[model samples]
Target: MTNSKVGHRIEELTTPAFLLDLVKVKSNCQGMLETCKAMGVSLRAQTKTHKTVEGAVLQTGGSRKGIVTSTIDECEFYADHGFDDILYGYPLIAHHMPRISALTRRLEKFHVMVDSKLAVETLIASQPPTGKTWSVFLKVDCGNNRAGVWWEDEESIILAHQLGSYSSLITFRGLYVHCGNSYYAKTDVEVEKVRDENIERLLNFVDRVKERGVTCETIGIGSTPSCKKPSDNMKKLDELHPGNYVFLDVQQSTLGSCIVDEIACRVATRIIGHYPKRNQMLIDCGFTGLTKQGEGMLVTGYGIIRDNPNLKICNMTQEIGYIEPLKGKLDFEKYPVGSLLFIFPWHSCATAAMHSVYYVIEEDKVVAEWKPTRGW
Candidate 1:
């Protein structure tokens, strides 16, 4: 379905279509690349947000390399499309060995992340594809409290030593932390504080490991909020892997990672019905189209209706959204039936994952349609 409607305006597209602003996407990708260069660190762009090959290519700045994927499917999809230096930045389990082993063999620089002794032991027990060693990254929990061994835990140091002990079977890559907690920050100052704190903790852990004589070839941390507003101290790290910056969302904007005008993705819907009696208009988008992720977080409800700040998405069903005004009445005359309305998603990643295809727009016209590779 590539370029399905190459020359049509977005208003002509079917309702509830996912739209990607090509220009904004390019700007976002280039900005991140330039940010990494200025910080003197590499950018291992994550592909979980927009999983299209075109987006990934733009992310890498046409290098076709240095990407960390969240799933084996994304890894294979990139590999199948000639992307190299891929990292399966997820916890390893015995169940994923076969596919991991294959990916390790297939790419020149494929790596996996692990946070447990079992993962290291699993890699030690299984031999890599003949001439390869199991490249592993120690996932460190630096305040995010998600995956990865805790940075302050003595067990974290022991785990690194354990991986070092088996040099023949496994190669300890480095530390990877997801600074997801940065999302909780209420202001830009708090976001930078979280970034600096996480970096300090991670570097301290690296020093402790160095005392034990374990070297971390690559050290990196990532979260859209942190990476987008990078601290000067981020230069100490070796890499930054952030995905959501490709399509800055309302959430990112609120975090000060980007302004609302920079958001590159939107759900294009239309007015399906008008109910002036109840002061509400019905849009052809619901939880399925825009997702219910940012519910109660934004005053506008599930998503921000572009160019219509007064219009609020008050409620939604599976395939319909109820819209009214923030204050008084919703003038149905201004929003006639069949008129198009674009919604900037609250969480671009969650919202993007719901759509099968993305309409690539430039100057209000659809120039291409990108089909993202789906599934875990």
Candidate 2:
């Protein structure tokens, strides 16, 4: 963002807009890429967070492929734009296998998740071309209790080895685990422990499988909170996928992942009205635009106001926000009506996904703008 361009864009645009600092965005992107380089693993970033092609490109380093999507529509959109090697990363519902088979036809390598006999049977019945390999990974439950097989369950253990039988069409990729508990870590020290423990358990699972000559071809592990604090533990995995680092949100900040300066995206709103008597103010930005996420009883608001830390967006209605001024604080002389303010969301990915386009800023100025790809 430049000084002149900031003025130009401010004049050209209306309030309640999405602002993106490319400088900060680039830095955030580079930090995660560097972490992957140091870990000696392939980075197949999860795109469910950003849900944008521009956001995806910034994190791609040089390659425009080998990414993960959360939805079938997202997979089709990315593949249409020449992005191959996509892993849906979610559970394989039996009814969705037909659509999944169609996606396999569009990519060089398409990976799916399998954790049940029903899912496996449906996948076998709906197979794609023999020329392009269809790969499947068993989602391991590393004590997350999520949608995955227990690491030591006899059924899961037997299924892991049985996958080798579909040698002609479906190939066993490896064990896939999402260490969701990593987010519970309070400090960087604790976060590193979570990372190490996740790697230890998953690698132990790998060793357990290798005992039967059923070596995992791809060992995958990730969680944004886990990757935020890098560790030597990552060396055990073949690939790492972390998505939310592209836009550092307040949630990441609360988790101690990154600071406000590292935050690349924000919501720009104007002070529409003031209530000096009630010690509050109103802004045009609301849940419809800013996204109702990353805030709760503790946060107690939609987002954090960058200029005023003590001020609380305590109350929010359809088209207004009540800015609770600190006790006995009534100083709207400095903040007047129509003043543009920046807000950092609790979840960067969720907030940014709702935005239509982003104004690229540099040095506190808007210099460029980029539209984001939105939808499932």
Candidate 3:
């Protein structure tokens, strides 16, 4: 079941190994499940962070049902593996209709999100499998302008009305929002502010849709920062989808989603060389292992070295990372060559994308290996 034989000791494994702490993953997943439960909403956990089947199972608390994906391939991958109620939570394009049709016919509840008029028209023109209809969720902006139609814009209502009009071909499920702006908040209060604001906007938009005579069967919002610390207003929504909480990163910690200890995934690298002359060291990890998404945002550099505040990953090449002391000169003796060091990534989704296989570890022993599905 492993892609390759994993060694007993973590230190024995190859450097730059993607390590997933199974215990923390379970705890994090449980915490999110409890959060959604307390909020009185369904948790349609997103699988874009750790696209492994095992992670999805844990996110769903073994139900293997209620899940959303960032790509169509993930939708198919999950469907092929017996998961249902899958939503291709991306802005739909015409080219992907063939596969979408296949998934719609295969799964009991395969949904798609749309934010544009072209997407609505495309879905209307494309007939679903015999006796089947395309389940659609209108993506609303709700202050996160990344994708979704703007909540204040008239087009948002127009699109929803159009989707609902074609009842024979498209079943307008409801509204969906990303609420990604919560990450921009520096304090927990600020994060809550963003979350509450988005909720207010979303609910208002739902009211407008209802005014247009379109009934929203479900209303959902996602983003680890907001979903982790859900407010009372979230109870009004029907679903919450947060993916990065399963393997929280330093960014999530800063956003008050989880503490640094709750981060379940890390890049296990080793000190390969020490350069006292330049007060720096080199590790066998680079942009290829841990992405540079955290660049300039963290004082600890690309990633936070676990339990080593003095160390900072300053720079990275293709296969090597530059580490330097955060304050004073480097004490090379303390960190000997070949010694193990784990780096908590700033963005787990980006870091996870860099590795094909993740070593699932428990108490420093490799218990399993998780291979994620790749490609857009």
Candidate 4:
């Protein structure tokens, strides 16, 4: 049944609405889940990309568990929805401990990540209620250099030992790393290469920690690009967490992680004006709608027009997106004022974050509305 509240047809919805293709979303989830199963790893579906209970349910295949969130709000949102096992995959903030402690008391298993002594110390300082010990993972910087202690650094081992020493307040769960560098790779081979290198470094870190007599229970690693086209060499890793695979964007497509057809989310907008002499068309979608993210290899524009990839969103203001022809001339009559268009975002995660709700579409009809948990 079509969701009457949001409108049945995509065109009927208000301009600058986020759209999620139900079929594509399910396929992406199933494909990644199968990939993890084949690689002998568990899929800890990252909810950071689509911070909605419905999307998380689909990503987890109705298990309503094994999730990785970027914020405490997401953790609380999912936990309230009966998602018991969750890993807050960000460096622990001392100020957020009160809420974290409250969540830990209720959840069956709520884990957090720490890359420094301060984070570990903070976790130790903030003790949960009785019978509650925080499950924690050491964020190891495999190669991305974004967060986490470097894999080769002895500090990781030191921190593991420190976390272990405070066994009553914290449990040193395992190691976690994000291969963010894979997003910069221009080809599938390079993406797989990054994945292999990241896994190798992660395993090396695990071994070094084990040599010190500490048993790392869960070795979690993944980025959407790496997991979508994982290297066959991935073995021994206990879990995989890839967020963007839920709704691949132009960036993933350009990186060869997923084909253009696999992009599941887009901004549905309407043409507001046309400038024939300037060869540009104005749309109601803007930075707040499509986001200003683009691929490293091609500076196509803010987003790719779903029907006409040649039309680039060259510039955008708060609510106005300027679409100009990247190649050849623009036909004004083809996209007159009020004409609706679907624009596949450059980065689905950022683009989706701009909207509060997604008009869930299946067979070109709105079947449901997914409300995302927003804010820090």
Candidate 5:
């Protein structure tokens, strides 16, 4: 039934094709499932990384099928596809109220994160579907100090109380935090240290809210680097909300979140230009195919040329990759003009965001054509 579709995907495949290994992708999905189930924690895998119904279906294990989305566009895409529980992971922004309100109606259980008084106050002002209860989670900043509120902050505890007061305006589901700082840890021991600090900080807040007689729903934490090592500390929270696990990339692999074998997606490109004199080759894949964003300390190239790890395709313009040799000088003879090459991106999110569609590859052949729901 899908042979022609696969064939079409291969034929129309131009330069910089997104190649997804179905087997690896599914394995990564089930691994996340096992980690969540074993921890006795609710696993709501974030779908923003792979904003497609096909991707969501793979993550639905043991009837717990909820997924997290960073943008309202993803929520809408998945909702129409019949995905019920959608958590917009980002703090609800000011101008996006209309969509949030509309999406709430479409979803069976729609939740958004909030931390600042301004955001909470704005959400209240938006008056999104008063008849329909909109769930909210307080964003806790354990250590990363990004969008979340400090766990012990009096202002945060007070807002939780205020939001809980209005049953009509909002349903205070729980407090959520993302241990984003774990990415900086050089070792598992260091990551575990961050984990303990994060959990302790969040638990302290839970204790404070409970003292105020405020009913707390769930305690949540996310981030691929932190939750990737579930045995270390992810289960400490009631739920884990790691997204990049869907399509593990170079960044996650280096962090030990995933193995090189677990990387589910890659960019397929053809060698076009070879500068034998300068010891540089060029692939049709460029910054558009890869990401401008690189990984930590190591000069994480735009993306990795997986076939040859030693040879880094370091520099990239819009349409070309300045490929260099890992060993000796000129090796244009090794790679023919039409040879297909695979590239592992610096970050999965960046690569996924730019591409319109991804081709599921199996046994070195194209299989399923999955279209990502892009924007916001």
Candidate 6:
């Protein structure tokens, strides 16, 4: 789904459009790839953040060619784009088997994550007529406590053995864990501490499972915060899957994962009204433009003004954003009506999902329009 209107200027485009700086995006992807290479781990670029084929190809860098997707639609989209090795990172549901089965036949390698016995049973029962075995990864909960079985749980060991026993229908891939808690960290020390702790826990669990005669071919560990500011302990992981590094937001900036300048995506909006007496300005962007993801200390509102860092998107209606100074009196004269402003979202992933297309910006001009896959 390519938008043929390429080389349009940012100002010429409609207001409230998502802008992706190709330079920053490529730099982020290259940095992560090099980091994983230096740490001796494979980089399974996560596509859940930037769900576009262009972004995926950039992330893979034509090497390793591994990607992690969060939805079956994403699986189909990437598979159609000739991305053969894909991991559907979410826990498996029984009803998704038909599509998963189809994908397995089409893809060179298609893997799914599972954390329960029912998921395994469902996969075995729905084994496709193609006779291709389903690749499975046991999702281990390494302190995130979001999903997956607890790392030390004895049942996890039992589940691993059970999965390994299904030699005919299933190929046990490895262990996967997301250090989501690292996003809550406020300092670099805390971020590193969480990263190291996750590594140690994942390694310990891998050892425990190995002792039980289960071979984990891969040990996946990562989140944007952990992967960007990884500790020396991360050298032991087999692969890293960090998505948001593609377009860092205020949340990552606050977590010390990246600085504000590293953020690659922003919303370009125009000031529609100005309330000089109240020191507030209304912009043609709001929750519909930038998602309300208040994840970090630096994000006190809907989003941050890129040029005026101190100006906060204090409130938002469906289509209107209110901007006001956070530290000092708002200077309405500095921002007149019809002025263009770029807003860095608090969470890039959520903000990106709101837009169907991304306006690629390079050297102060729109280079291309990237259409991301939509639907669950």
Winning candidate number (lDDT): 1
Each model's lDDT comes to 0.92, 0.77, 0.92, 0.86, 0.80, 0.87
| Regions more than 4 Å wrong, model 4 | 1-7, 295-299
Ranking by lDDT: 1, 3, 6, 4, 5, 2
Candidate 4 shows a clash count of: 0
Write down the RMSD of all candidates, one decimal each.
Answer: 1.1, 3.0, 1.3, 2.0, 2.5, 1.8
TM-score of each: 0.98, 0.92, 0.98, 0.96, 0.93, 0.96
User: Model 1 segments beyond 4 Å from truth?
Assistant: 1-3
Candidate 3 ranges with C-alpha deviation above 4 Å: 1-3
Candidates 1 and 5, the one with greater TM-score: 1
Error of 4 at 210 (Å): 0.9
Model 2 stretches with alpha carbons more than 4 Å out: 1-8, 297-300, 364-368
For 1-376, candidate 6 gives per-residue lDDT tens digits of: 9545477788787889999999999999989989998988999989999899999988999653699999999999998888878999999998888888888888888999999989988887876547678999999998998989899889988998888898888899999999998987879899888888888989999898888898999998879999998657787889999999999988898888889999999999999998878988899998888876773345447667877868888788889988888787877778878889998888999999999989999977888889999987
Candidate 2 structure, TM-score to reference: 0.92
Candidate 3 per-residue lDDT over residues 1-376, each given as its tens digit: 6346465779778889999999999999999999888878999999999999999999999999999999998998898788999999999999999999999888999999998999998998898999999999999998876998999999789889998899999999999999899888999999999899999999999999999999999999999999988777899999999899999999998888888999999999989999989999999999999989978998899989998998899999999999998899988899999999999999999999999899999998898889999887
Tens digit per residue, CA lDDT, model 4, 1-376: 8445454777678889999999999999899988988888999999989899988898888999899999999999898889989988889888888888888889889988898989887887776789978999989887898999988878778888787777788888888989999987878889888899998898888888887888888997889988887656676789898999999988898888889899999889999998888989899988888777773334557777877867877888999999888888998888889989988888899999999888999877888899999977
Candidate 3 local Cα displacement, residue 66, angstroms:
0.9
Model 1 weakest 10-residue run by lDDT: 1-10
Question: For model 1, what is the error of residue 218's alpha carbon versus the real structure, in angstroms, after optimal superposition?
Answer: 0.8
Clashing residue pairs in all predictions, respectively, total 0, 3, 0, 0, 0, 0
lDDT of 4: 0.86
